[model samples]
Target: MSHSTVSIIAQCKAAGLRRTKALELLIDTLLASPRPMTLAELSEHDNLNTQCDRATVFRLLQRLTDKGIVRRLGLHERAAYFTLLLTGRHQDFLICTDCGKIEAINAQCPVHALEKEIAQKSGFTGLYHELEFFGTCPKCSV
Candidate 1:
């Protein structure tokens, strides 16, 4: 298991969630994935498909999302994408409009400072932001 996965599992335990087989598999899958996964994609994973039903996956995702262990990316596509939310790790994505490919932007997040400033001004705690850029990828443009 990865450090992120272990941390998330610890968080789940702290939140009173049990360490089920399905939950463990789901976390492993999400951590191994290079990008955010859709419900269909997650359900179709070989390990998860055999062990748990689609409904189980959906419910687990919902619970994790509620607990801030997972993040639902509201991209332009009809399907929602989910990714694990590692502590102190933030990322932005570049989404290809034509092919629907999502790539993590390697640059430092420019919005963190702004988010802090806004939070201080508004007296809000635990403020965070999600940023994504939409454009045609080179493959799609060709």
Candidate 2:
């Protein structure tokens, strides 16, 4: 879901964090982003660079990750990408390698029964899942 500055500020408050200029910029950029963004992309965004550097971006990402405000996706051998999770929807992705687009696919547990069986057989607890599919998007495939 696209977000506005007021909502972002509220999110910060909900996360038990204070609002700062840098955080504002980062949140704004991520909320407006069309797809998951890498550190390089965050660094290059004009709004975040005036006061934020690599380390600051890293710190913000780490903090947000811990707060469950964002999720990281590993795309092939490329830099890890972060997508904001403000909507609180747990979903996977269809990543387009050629165009760098990240589209969220609704969560469907294709291996639900397998997970239960595996847990029972292996005596493991709290099993979870994450999935991603990568290839050229239609625009790029053409």
Candidate 3:
């Protein structure tokens, strides 16, 4: 198994969750998705043949979130999406309303520089930030 998968399994185990059918379904669903997915979408995946209830999905999401295997995006007060990323390769996201696409933007991220400036100005250290930009994609513009 891939290191991330192994890590996820280990994390779940450490959190008092067993490596069971539900966990396997959760992992497979997250890996297969190219973009962040909401719990509703994940639970509805046909291929999983998942018998686990919504509560199981929620619990697994929480465990994965704590482990950093998934990054959470709060779209609104009511809904959030969980996206997969390689560890340490964190980047902001741009969600396209038209095509339901997600684009990662990392080049020349001002957030990095801003953090440095903030630290220099405030005499603080060891800080980071999360940034996400949402808009209609190119195809949607036309």
Best by TM-score: 1
Name the runs in model 1 displaced over 4 angstroms: 1-3, 14-18, 74-77
- The best candidate in terms of lDDT: 1
Residue 73, model 1: lDDT of 74
lDDT per residue as tens, model 1, 1-142:
7777788789999977889999999999999998899999999999699999999999999999888888887555557789988867798988887777778899999999999999999999989888989889999998
- Scored against the true structure, residue 69 in model 3 reaches a CA lDDT of 62
Worst 10 residues of 3 by lDDT: 83-92
Q: Can you write out model 3's per-residue Cα lDDT over 1-142, one digit (the tens) per residue?
A: 5577777677668867778878877887787777778888887887444578777788878877786566788555546788765555567888765555666784767777778889999998756667888788888998
Instruction: For candidate 2, give the lDDT of residue 90.
Output: 49
Which RMSD values do the candidates have, in order? Answer: 2.3, 5.0, 3.8
lDDT of 2 by residue, 67-104 (tens): 86778886656677997775534467888887667777
- For model 2, state the Cα shift of residue 112 in Å: 12
Model 1: per-residue Cα lDDT at residue 72? 83
Alpha-carbon lDDT, every model: 0.88, 0.79, 0.73
lDDT of 3: 0.73
